[model samples]
Target chain A: MITFYEDALCENCYAVRLLLHMLAVPYTSHFIELYPSRANLQPRFRAINPLAELPVIDDDGVIIAGAAPILVYLAAKHAPGTWYATDTPALAQVTHFLTLAERLSATVGAARRHESGFAPTDLPAAHTGATRLLRGLDAHLWFAEQQGNAWLLPTPHPTIADLACFPHVILCEEGGISRQPYPALRRWCDRVKRLPNFLVMPGVFLTAPPKTE
Target chain B: MPDPTTANLWHPIAACADTPVGTPQRTTLLDTPITYTLHGEGHATAASSSMLPVLIRYGYIWTSLGTPTADLFDIPEYAEPDRRRFNAASVSVHVSAPRAVENFLDMSHFPFVHTGILGAEPHTEVKEYDVETSAERDEVLATRCRFFQPQPSTAADQGAEVEYVYRVPHPNCAILYKSSVIDETRRDVIGIFVQPVSQERVRAHMLVCVLDDRSDDETIKRFQQTVFGQDKPILENQFPKRLPLDPRAESPVRADRVSIAYRRWLSAKGITYGVIPAA
Candidate 1:
């Protein structure tokens, strides 16, 4: 049985879960909340993943650390034709998107942790980082619309790039980022919402007893 | 605007704006958007846009029907398309889910998800799918995705009929579909897009279709039943979460062209397609 570690609300974890579901590959989930894990701080968890992230999937001896790599690896092995590019040149493009995606994860992930944590934040630095990331997305989307939907490469199908970018983009609202004015994006979301085997990220419902209650 | 509609035909629907509140207008569903309010008492306006009108000499129009109680298939009226379409084509889907309704055009998932229907290979053929949008192309109310199945061998002709006609999102956002290949006269695809009104409770709309050619309605219904029957459990079981990509971490490929193009389209339109860009 494939056992993947994850948190309930972690954005990247949710992206991974969505990917697994789309592939229709069944796996066991091991909920490992990142907040204050005294027990999992043991050497075993760290051994599985050097970063100690939420989604360190342990499928037998084949341990996968990051959500991005793990997803591509899992899908490549299980649902190869759908998302993976068997071709060499396309693999390089996938690598580029993955690299950029990792940088984004680092920036957005840090900012989110900063907010979720009751700790102090370097406000100006955070803002600068977010602005830069949003700027790249803004230009990319704008240019794509002008071209009537030509991609970085000609795709015969939807690849990991589409799946990888989904979760964080939706969650950016948590950091006060709104994608309202982008008509092409709104339409695209409409399209994503249409695909089968899609899953929305789950989070805590606002209506809950106060800590005291 | 005098005769401003670019469509070759003039399809009229009920003008809910003109109708008084609480009164159900008898309207034909004109490609669904402008549900024709039939009763001359209400508005003769939403007449047959279809060159044909079947069951819709009358029906109720809701200014705001947020959720239906059960699946559209469970509805008695959905059993009869002739009554509603007045001989024109019509289809109903159960729920108003944004995703399931849209999958008809989301050709990306076919290889793994539905390998039986769509052959397991990279189909590089990028033909145009017509979108019926608002005058400004902002609102894609409907789309016509067309594709032809390749001939398997020179001896045997390899052409499979493929067309997924769409209607834009309603309050339910359920994906509704219609097909012309099943029968030139076939109306509607089976299934209703269902959404949960509460956590576990669902609202649905069942669709009926009239198959074309000599194949009776029963044969078409059986075929549809066998096919869509397989998808129901899987989609419903996929609740709560999906495979996460963390684009920040994964690589993309040329085969992802449609997905990449879609992502770009989304990011431009104010839809946050991924978090990688901003971070």
Candidate 2:
């Protein structure tokens, strides 16, 4: 059992929520308001994380903050060798993409918050940065598809890295970032949506199932 | 008059292996789109509005948007019998060429950006290094920099302290020579050649020449690709797509000596194709 601190519209929280559903882990939710009264600044939430960030998890008293770290911990503890590999080099490669996912939270996630009136930021810079990230991700996925590797890492399984990055990229349209130009990324997003126990947030929708011949 | 920055420098447009015989490859250099085909006799013909010189070297197709004053810089290691050269796939980035070149010259981001592989959080400090511009070769060089890597190369089985030297021979090309794990005396040379597709776009071609016999060609190429894949998002999302030329534009620390020298060199050369003019 886990206690997930989440918000429906928060991209980071969406990643955590998605992972929990995919792993079929039972968890209770603590809904936190991101705006209009600022519930995250409350004393109860501040006790959890000094920074008061979203997507925190309390896995039976093992409290973890931040979306990336919490996802890593969950995958490591709950679904090891499945959602996360235990090998050193494979873990290192997953860490690389996890770091990249944090970058996406800063750039693409920031842009979405600004566009949706949830936060204030340098909008133009955020948009530019988000576009750049999307372009690189598109290229990477294109090559990965070419090499017959479907996930972010070169394995047959989807790791926490893919779950960490998927939320913001799929919801980027709300921030005025389009997925039309990235054919490979769009296809990859569909593949992720088709994963077992996948859940959808407000801005993200279920991808159409592939047609059978 | 043609812009001297675009006219007098050679930019690598595509990999030789990517441009097979009789197949036309299309790419952009300095904002001009051109299509060229390689023939059976080792000659290339281009169909464009203007004529441009082309050269094939180091497994890359080099072209100029204007008249070039000098040939491409030489890497003597290419002739060494023990060295193996690899031409990795080109990465298309949405940042200016100067920005990409500057990022390649920077090593401080290894820990915070690249993380576990290139560096770890506890070993984040970058020791002081030496930076100088060679008058003879007209290139920016940085030496004596060192960092601890969990996996220095694809073939490495353990962590090692890697010595590094960086060179910026052209406004858009940066090369790195790092100590090799397999060979105690020899080092690995990697070149990043950025082609300025437009004012705010670039395509980076990476060439790895190493003396390691431990890893196969596919392994080497995949490792390089994975490393570069880690850098792509960071490079693209950097604010101010065009690099700022002013020393005061962005704050710099001791670890940024290479980036400072490279920016200063670009400013001194009067290159403005992909740079924000000093305010």
Candidate 3:
């Protein structure tokens, strides 16, 4: 069992919860309100996570913070399947996406914050950064689909790379970036959403199931 | 400024569910910031001096910038006792309100946009449909439309030839009546009530009333959202952003009768806010 600290609408927190639900791990939720009061910055929470950010998990006595690291830690421990890649090439790609997720958090995530008036951020720069990343990802997924690959990496099963990039990409519209130009990216999102036990937050929407035949 | 023709008509500003009681929710309608607080049931008051008139109907908070001469269009099936009516969260799109409504009337994009669910490759043909404008009711109607769908509804077990009838009762609103898998005699009503946030922006409010016994609220809402989710990107990516009213502004084939009728009707009605005028 784990104690999870999260904001209900946090994109990063949504990613961790998606993995948790996929892995069917039981956990107790500690809701941290991040708006109006900025409760996460309170001293009581600062003692647990110095960064004062959400999606921090306490697995027994060990504490893990941030979405990417927590996803890796949870997948390595709970996933009996191929969520986190072990092969050298695949692992490198997975690590690459995990690192890129930070950029997503900085750009798209920051834009959402700026839109919500949570913080004073450069909305234009954030939108530009997000557009560049989304275009790159969309082209990658388009070619991947041409080659009969579904996940981020050319693997049969989806790795943490898919989960890492999903929340940011899907929720980019809140930051003023539209997913409209990226058809392949939108399809990939549908694939991710249709994944077994895929979770949705307030802003994150659901996709229809694939054909049964 | 918002088009006077459209401004005079009522438009949904937000879903009732999105505006919890006692909390003020802010949203833009027709390029104007609208802030409303719900203190008591069915009673809403706006914050600003230029506040628009508010009306709650069909699970949404509708407002009008100018005087409205007509009531909100009726959906008779919504009153059915056995039917389940669900409201999907409001989706914001970069396209104009009319663009969103026009997309709702199109069946050609289902295969490419909503592939594997609403339609699929090789079954991409949209059969001939009849289009008519009812002068008496002032609405556009398209009937006898048929399309091949992989999974027509969440309650559907297999692919089937789905029957459809599309109606455009307002400039920014379109209603869909499709064949029901559970009750063949009845049709599931799905509507897109668009809020024109600006000349090139909209907030789409989805209304669904279905006669299904098996699926739960979450399942039905998810299916509808999934279909609309696929449309959101395409709607946003449309060039010009605003819908063109000229017949020759964009090429149309035999399948676009409904869309053509809709544009012509909009032109006839002098709705100029979210449209490019004919050359």
Candidate 4:
């Protein structure tokens, strides 16, 4: 069992939540308030994650902070072959996109925070950076699809990279970054949503399942 | 005859690649809220407050707010087996459609607006180009234009002289055919489809069809995306959101011949949707 520290509105927490649900792993969520009154800053939560950042996961005695790290740790321990690949090349690609996901949190996620009054940010710069990243990601996915790869990495199966990038990119519109410009990314989001056991948080919705002939 | 500006034009609202199966995409065209969805047999249907005519062409979903007087613009290169096509992300600017169209028509901004990549500071000269109205097609054509670019396309790693031909088939559509880095005999075609959200905002959809097989779709998209990304800030920061039709409203130089012709054409067609009429 995993103790998942998360916020319903935080995209970072949502990333880890998505992975946990998809893996069908039993976990109890400790909901934290991010704004108005920062409950994560409370002494009790800070004892769990000194950084006061979400979403940290306590796997029995072992605790992990941040969404990417939690995703990597959980996938490696539980759903290895499926959610997380053991191969070095696939792992490297996953790590690369995980870093990109963090960047998205800072930019796209930051813009959303600014718009929703959760945090203060340079709105224009955040939006510009987010747009640039979206364009690049869209192009990458476009070529990936052209080569018959559905997810971010070249693997036949969806990996942590898809999960890591999914939430922020899908919910970027709340931050004034429209995903309409990125068709490939949007399609990739739909693919992620269609995965079995996929769950949605607030501001995220399920896409219709793919049709069968 | 129906109003050419309002009735006869097809505006690209979204890219086919962006509009996937089972989801509805919403956008505003001419201040009208539009909802588009892909249905059975891969048909794209668009609806607003009322019925809208929708057509999918060259990897884009085009719709008209009013009755379309003509079919979507023809691109023979779309059928060419040797060419590769890319649909870049749509860029939204806080400027009117006419201003956006005029910016697309102007080449002088390449050095200042798109410096280093599209042009250089030293090569600011705009050589003479010929612009005329193609009566048969009812389009404005600008030909024999040439410019130097540091990196013309993703396939080009070095600077090269690029030949250009600008075509405006509709009030809100502009296409540029420029020399390809891979094959000099074959030119790359880029179409800028502008959607007027309101009097002060527009979205530009870019379609690139090139004869080069060297680069992948991602590379082509990134190159175009970078170029347009550089242009967005300048377009958004421009003084007047709506383009002024009067020649005296803004100073025109030799390099603005295509822009002048476009303005004249828009004025003649009475496209007041996103234009500031002459005082």
Candidate 5:
């Protein structure tokens, strides 16, 4: 049995959930609220996975942290099917999407680490930086739609690509951003949630100063 | 009412070889990162460390790719003047656990979440099913068999013989279209793969394969955008609640046999999460 650390929402956490369901791998949940942690990494979670990401997966004793690491690990070790491509080229395409998702602002869970006092960035300031980030996301999702759904890359199930973007994209609306105007983007989010294991991510997880509820 | 989230469980999918490339390929029982080009060919390996197919839910999720119809239009709302936007299809929306049940309950979606696509009205069609059962883990398997026909396309061989075989491991299955040719190829399948991030949410990828690579790629992209994009807003409404099983009071039909079977299968495997015994 595997133990997954996640809140009810959190697109990234949802992504991990999505992967678990597709694999039909049974797992227990630890709904870590992420804010009260000393370094964002919960105390017990630190023992299971040094990193404090909510989507950590504890496979019996073998622990993996981060959405990317946990997903890739399961695909490689536990589940074997359409999701993990065998060849290099096919896999490379998936990697490209994963890398790209990290940079997009429209993603559901990407909070300003600096604004939240989590991490510092190379950017000058976050006010304009935030705007730029959201626009960049809208453009990218548009680009995805324009470039043929297959243009960006192709993967069965949500793969790590969708997983990478799930959290930030899902929660972007909570950051005073609305996917409603970005019709295409809005649709993408909706489509993503419909996938098995797709949970809703709340902005409060990464909300400013965290929350009491 | 019980939460839909607790009704099923999913497992990580194993990678498969022969993921068609050239002419849009489909994923196996489980959907993941696999693509095909124009013909029944592409580049992919079974269980490559570079990337592997992961599973979620109890087993009712998969990854697939599709090439939409030849008409490029990223929904008129996307106001981007770029016509060259859009590529191919690589997402599917079926949620079922493998070997857990039979017949995905499409009837419910018709009147509920997917009403727009199905053009269904409210409370119009409530169905009940007569099901046979088999059990495993915290799941079950109810099944029935039938012959299916693929929507004959002009691009397809008119004289082609076809026969479809259905063995639903769970509710995450399709009424597939098949060709009777002894060496017939399979494509245009809606893959089901579930990844459980929490007890409630899962990320699913849906894909469709097209026979004609000659079809304009842009048109296909728009089609995919609309299909997947439409499903997003609706799914946001799902909220899982813990509840005991409702016996007899729940109406079902022959189609339900598959769903029941999948629940049994998961139980036999001890793949429990948040569901009651599918007795």
Candidate 6:
């Protein structure tokens, strides 16, 4: 069984949780308190991961740190073809999106933490960076919709790319980033929410069910 | 030229179900922190430990930072016995209260923001509607508004051309009367009552009064959450955060008749709170 060390509100952690639930992977949760008292920064946790970043997963005692790496690990092991495209070009695109996800974590994630008093940083700078990222994401999704492609990559199903970026985009308002101007981004979120076995955390919400016969 | 007693207006601070008996709930109204308790009747205290005016109506706990200049506006549909009356989840938005109200009064964004649920593409045109300011009631009313909705409500299962009536009775509160799926003769009521937590922060409380026996609270709540969830990000993303009352600040189209009337009404009333004053 995978022992997932995570914080309920952490965006990176949510990415792992999304994949775990989507793949129907059974895992045990080791909840980490992130606010008021930063449990992740403690010495005991430092022993597990010197970086002290959240979302370190222990897969049957095999330790893994960082969200993207863990996602790649899980997909390569469990549902490789559907989630983590192994082909040359698709693999490159997945890697590209994972990098964007890290950028989202640095900007939108930092802004949210600052708003919650979890960390202090330049809020305006974070907002500016997040806005640029979201604008690019919106334009990409708009063009994708024009081609009848729903997911981040032009695959029939969603990749880790969608899962990696979904949390921050869904929860951007908490960090003072608005989704209103991005119609395509909002539509993509709704599609992601309608995915089978989709899980919702506290901040993430469920969309209306798709039309059925 | 906003009224000096702008803070005197009543705003919904909490849902009735949220503030339980003997449990003091902390909330904000117009940037002032308030604590409230419901022991049969509702009582509230400001952060300054002074007693604040409270009114429990429309399934929400209304509070004022100062004495209200007028009584709380009426939603007679809320008193309807057969209606499935409930408070949809309260949403904290990063936009000004006036901006939230203005969005509620708009239908043009439905095809885009709401997509398949409230509206869809290819049916994007918002037909002309009648809008007027009721002098005696001091409210902005838009009548004869119609739109093509894929699913108008939780009870709706198919597409329909929905008729709508919008009322802006207060600066931060807007109510919608839409054609109902259950009872076509009667309109379902949806109200967005905004509490201005600060210049660019608001807690939007939604009240739904509809004649639908097919769906329960959770089903209805989920539908409303889905709809508002789509709007929240857009509301936060709007430039300037606050509603621009100046006609020149943002461009408008023919479909924005109700929104234009709402801005005109706010301008005439000199409501500057949560809005950019016309220069």
DockQ-based ranking: 3, 6, 2, 4, 5, 1
Model 5, residue B250: C-alpha shift (Å): 40
> For every candidate, how close is chain A to the native chain A in TM-score?
0.81, 0.97, 0.97, 0.97, 0.69, 0.98
State the weakest 10-residue window (summed lDDT) of model 2 chain A. A30-39
TM-scores across all candidates? Answer: 0.40, 0.61, 0.73, 0.60, 0.36, 0.68
Pull out the clashing pairs in model 2. B7-B66
Cα deviation of A167, candidate 1, in Å: 1.4
- For each candidate, report its DockQ versus the true two-chain complex: 0.01, 0.03, 0.11, 0.03, 0.02, 0.07
> A56-175, model 6: which lDDT tens digit per residue?
999888999999999999998999889989899999999999999999989988898776445768999999999999999999999999999999999998999999999989988778
Interface RMSD of 2: 18.3
Give fnat for candidates 1, 2 and onward, in order.
0.00, 0.00, 0.00, 0.00, 0.00, 0.00
Number of clashes in model 4?
2
Q: Relative to the unseen true structure, what is the C-alpha lDDT of residue A120 in candidate 5, on a scale of 0 to 100?
A: 32
Local accuracy of candidate 5 as per-residue lDDT tens digits, A167-211: 665655433345565666565666665655443332322112223
TM-score of the candidate numbered 4?
A: 0.60
Q: Each candidate: RMSD to true structure?
A: 20.9, 18.1, 7.7, 17.8, 22.2, 9.4
List model 2 lDDT by residue over A1-213, tens digit each.
799887656789888988889988899877765542255788989999889878788888899999888888989888998788899989998898899999898898898776544576898999888889889999999999999999988889999989999988987866668789999988989999999898766545567788889
Interface RMSD of each: 20.8, 18.3, 7.9, 15.0, 15.9, 8.6
Runs with alpha carbons beyond 4 Å of true place in candidate 2: A1-213
Can you give the lDDT of residue B226 in candidate 3?
60
Candidate 4 falls in which docking quality class? incorrect
Tens digits of per-residue lDDT for model 3, A1-213: 799998666789889989999989999877775643356888999999999998899999899999999999999897735998877888889999998888988998899766543565888899999889889989999999999999899989998889998999888876777889999999999999999898766556567688898
Supply candidate 1's per-residue lDDT for A183. 51
List model 6 lDDT by residue over B62-152, tens digit each. Answer: 8777679999888888888999887875777778888899899999989888878889999998998999999899999999999999988
Output the worst ten-in-a-row residue range by lDDT, candidate 1 chain B.
B1-10
